[model samples]
Target chain A: MRKWILLLAVFLAACTTKPSFTSENVYVGTDGVSLAFTKNSPPAEVFENSIFPVGIEIWNKGAYNVEEGYALVNLDQDYMEPGEFTGSTSIFPSDASKLDFQLMGKSEISQQGDRDTIGLTVLTKPIDILSEKHTSTVSVMACYRYQTFASPNVCIDTDPFGIRENKKSCTVSDIPLTGGQGAPVAVTKVEVKMLPSKSQDKVVSQFRIYVKNMGNGQVVDASKVADACSSEGLTKSDINSVSVSAQLSNGIVLDCIPKREGNGGLEGYLRLKGEDYVLCNYEEGVPMELGTFKTTLNIALDYGYMHSISKDVTIRKSAVI
Target chain B: MEQKRVFLGVLVIVSLLIIGCSGSKGNQPTAVEFRTGSSGLDVTFPSGTPQQIFENDIDVRIPIQVENKGAFPQFDELSEFTGFLWVGGYDPNILQASFEQGDIRKQLDPEELEGRSSFNQQGGVVLESLILSVGDLPLGTAVYEPTLIFYLTYLYKSIASVPVCIDPEPRSINVKDKVCSLTDFRKIYSVAPQGGPVGITNVEEIITSNQIIFKFDLQNFGTGQVIARDLVSSNPNEGFDWRDLNRVQIEDVRLGDRSVDKCKPDLGEEVELFQGIGHFQCTLSVASIASAQAYTTPLTVTLTYGYAQSQFRNIKILEAIEI
Candidate 1:
């Protein structure tokens, strides 16, 4: 009976413990995808006029499901040709047309973290007897849609109302902040200041948001891709075009758009400079009743990312009897 | 049996004869031809040349050629000529030799040479006539050969220049292309400039009213000695003495501004890089400039001295007596 009672108490104590949260918003989807050649079977050598297998491993480490993912192979047509795989097609060196997609998986959801492997078969072209050995480089690329996030908490209070200390009913002190997260773009810093308006019923606040390009991808307009990222026909935009929105705890929404300065358009461009700090202005129509509130700010960033990894293979022309 | 014995005895005699010839050849001495040293100077009397003279030959002139086969050029005049050639030997006992007072210091033109003297090309040569004064020996003195050695001394000067970057302020704008600036002249000029026979090892700068003074130390980078100019000619009273020799002139002080006028070598017009190393100080007035921005300028120094180079020729001295 005592052992049973002790077990019940331990279970209750365990249920009462709160789960810890990440200090920053995590875009688990984008940061989790990793694609590479498997260690057991890498692209090293292939005999001329013969077929060989190349293996690739793709890992999905995000919280959400990958709707579509694929790998494309680029090779020199004069020296080699892709075998009759479903996605493999003949491409010239100068052919800039996007590679035809091979579906790696459909609705592949990674709960904790899961890795998938695929095999690609390739054949080398015939060579002359005088040419004993020839080297060719094959490039492999992975393309997919991903998401990331950044969250920063700021203080919003109306403290100078001359309320008696003895009758103090509200106070806002040091609250732990959630830092910045995501790929390609990250909110490096955020500062907020509230100033009293001359009118008796309103107040104005200024928000300075710092954004940085953390990856090699080109940031572009999200609307053009229809909420999904595409590697084709990628045109870049400036910082002024970045979309930002904020909301108070009382369900009041505020939009902060950047004004054009110099060569930077309405959304200042980073190609001209390297990074940017955007100033956002927000005005409250009604004065707060001497209290503290929690607010949320949303930052939307869109970009086109491309990664090219290559390997060298030698094709030998066997000696004829 | 007797015929075999005879054949064996003949074979033994032939073998002994062959061994005797081989032993004699092995004992013979090998003739080795020595490399006549310029070992400082390679001067020697030509083989088969007559050394003994008759009483009638009072001041007979001998031809001595000095081919500058060394790495450095011998000059006659630093301002105009390259080096001087003086031919005299060690022993003064048996013979007294004299050259023409004015002709004693002769100039060898290095300009006429086909190629300039560098690490690759051999230096030029100059041939001059040497007069030998033979004294009266007792009637039966032993006839022997006395070496006619020659000594050539001249002042050798080496010049080098370093680009000193000077700005009004004390900081280097480009860390990669370090220059001498006002902030730290010692740090930049702590080492010497390359591609010259001489190096300006150390330099110091002092800025005064309308004038900046640069103090420097010069070092010889060659294996040879640097001759002091003042010691070259014995008689300073004579007009041709090398009193003003070994003069180092700083020429073409450029400060980017074409309007920079009166940039003078304030210490003096000419200073000597004495004993391979010399201390030099000069000043330039920067007060006239309208702007005090930092800039780079070149400093060029030219050294002039009567350089000396030497070579040795082997000759055989023969005895010639008149009855």
Candidate 2:
């Protein structure tokens, strides 16, 4: 019974013990195993806010009989956490998806003696975090053909890589206030031409009126009556009582005739007494010319008391000149 | 008997070994667990007539009551707690005290609370002073509806922690009976330039020089009265310069009732001009000859006054224009 027990213990110990597999006196053929990251399959660049997917493939070259061993890849310690392989599957799984990887294809390679070159491809689905920076590593492992030996874990020393960048939106603040309606006013164009009346020694000029809506709204029942006038060239004492007729270019007769005044200047008020008289000043008048007696008409609107409109007009000399 | 003794000895040794090994692996306090309790406290300000407080009146008595519904015991000594009072996001530059132990309780010295004001004469009332204390508190004692925060120094084993905090709940306070007086007379407030020429010709530079001046229509607005004096001017990139410009007495210059002697009167009653209109004319100097870039300067005018010398107070108004 004692002998049987000792034998059982010896068997258990032998089963647990692993044979020594050292790299000594082992002749390596010219076809040495070489590992590389696959082409057209580089790791993805991750933005600060988004995620990236990566895959990696490895190539092994060895002439002599080699064991079917697995590869272990180690990401740079500073940038990424250590990554491990999934069970028998070729893909690698990462605990943190928010990481940037350097290489995409197979991060690990297995040693199969039947083929001159062995390859592996690993896919790492990682998310790129905008809040922080990250990096990853790649490595390979091979197993010997004999059960008694295995190859050392091989890893390529490469710089860590980051995911693609995500752009930040530009923003601004504190915009100023603007936009409001200004004052209300109006403008009128007057043309004066000196004509030889039937009984006058000097030529008398007839004043033609052209009223334009220059305020913010339309004008209705506008009465263009002269309040005062200059006696510099006229001979009438009731110049203040002198009434003259006027009309708009739209063929509408003005409500009241132009009244004369003794102020030696043509002074009048156009009573634009209506609510819908909405019209902008700049679009109200057409450019006209009368031969050389330059003058401007100033019209005041009731709404904006301080604002007024002015238009340039010309008077022609009689044929006597 | 010898064989029995040997067997007993072996058994004893085996039992001792097993006991020693198990003892080595006994329960240990390896990982520490930290527990925290959260609570809040509400503070109130007494309502009454507006108090008139001057710079000379430094120490002001503010009544504050602290109620704790948390599991922690109320601090026996008020000295263990720290408090702060904020008015309109500013320190009112006055010391706060309460009645405690048959004496006026002052947490901070008067020097620490001096020389702090809202700068802008905009008034603010003190809602409450947040008080915080750290000590062994019961589980629910420190946790209340309104959290109470104060400066506290506590020790857990060899580690000591001090936390400063404020109550996050919203509160309101009455305007205390106090008045602030100004020693210097500063800028007079007025509206910005308006009704000026729309189109300026011969544009050597877009001169804001041709300005249309209008008096502060006393009849329409009011008798422009001033109390405190604070003249503030700001540039584009630079900040505002708040300084005491000059001191002048208030002379009533209204057209109808109060007009200065030798001043002309027009339109019904005599219009009074408060101060020099020329003084308020801000010139917009052209900085660049080619670029149309212009800078806007804003002037903030603050007045300090009262019904009498004994009841002085201050107020502020702002005016800005593109220069």
- Candidate 1 ranges with C-alpha deviation above 4 Å: A1-32, A40-42, A60-71, A84-116, A127-129, A159-182, A216-253, A259-274, B1-323
- Predicted candidate 2 versus true structure: per-residue lDDT over A1-321, tens digit per residue: 999999999999999998984321121222222334444222433322222222333322332222232334333333333332322343324322111111111111322322222222333333333423343444332211110011111111010011111111111111111110111121123333333434422223333333332223222211211111111222233111112233222122333333233433223333343311211121122211111111111122221111111111111111222
Error of 1 at B76 (Å): 99
Error of 1 at B315 (Å): 99
Top candidate on lDDT is 1
What is the C-alpha DockQ of each candidate? 0.00, 0.00
Query: Scored by CA lDDT, what does every candidate get?
Result: 0.46, 0.23
Q: Residue by residue across B1-323, what tens digits does model 2's lDDT show?
A: 99999999999999999999998888653542121121112233356422322222223443443322111111222332232221111011111222332222223322221211223111112233322211221111111111111111110000001111111110213433222211121112323211110000110111223321112222111111211122111110111121211122222222112222221232222222234121211122222222232222221111111100001111111111112
TM-scores of chain B alone in all candidate structures, in the order given? 0.49, 0.17
Lowest lDDT block of 10, candidate 1 chain A: A163-172
Docking class for model 1 is incorrect
Summing lDDT over every window of 10 consecutive residues in candidate 2 chain A, give the lowest-scoring window.
A151-160
**Could you give candidate 2's fraction of true interface contacts?**
0.00
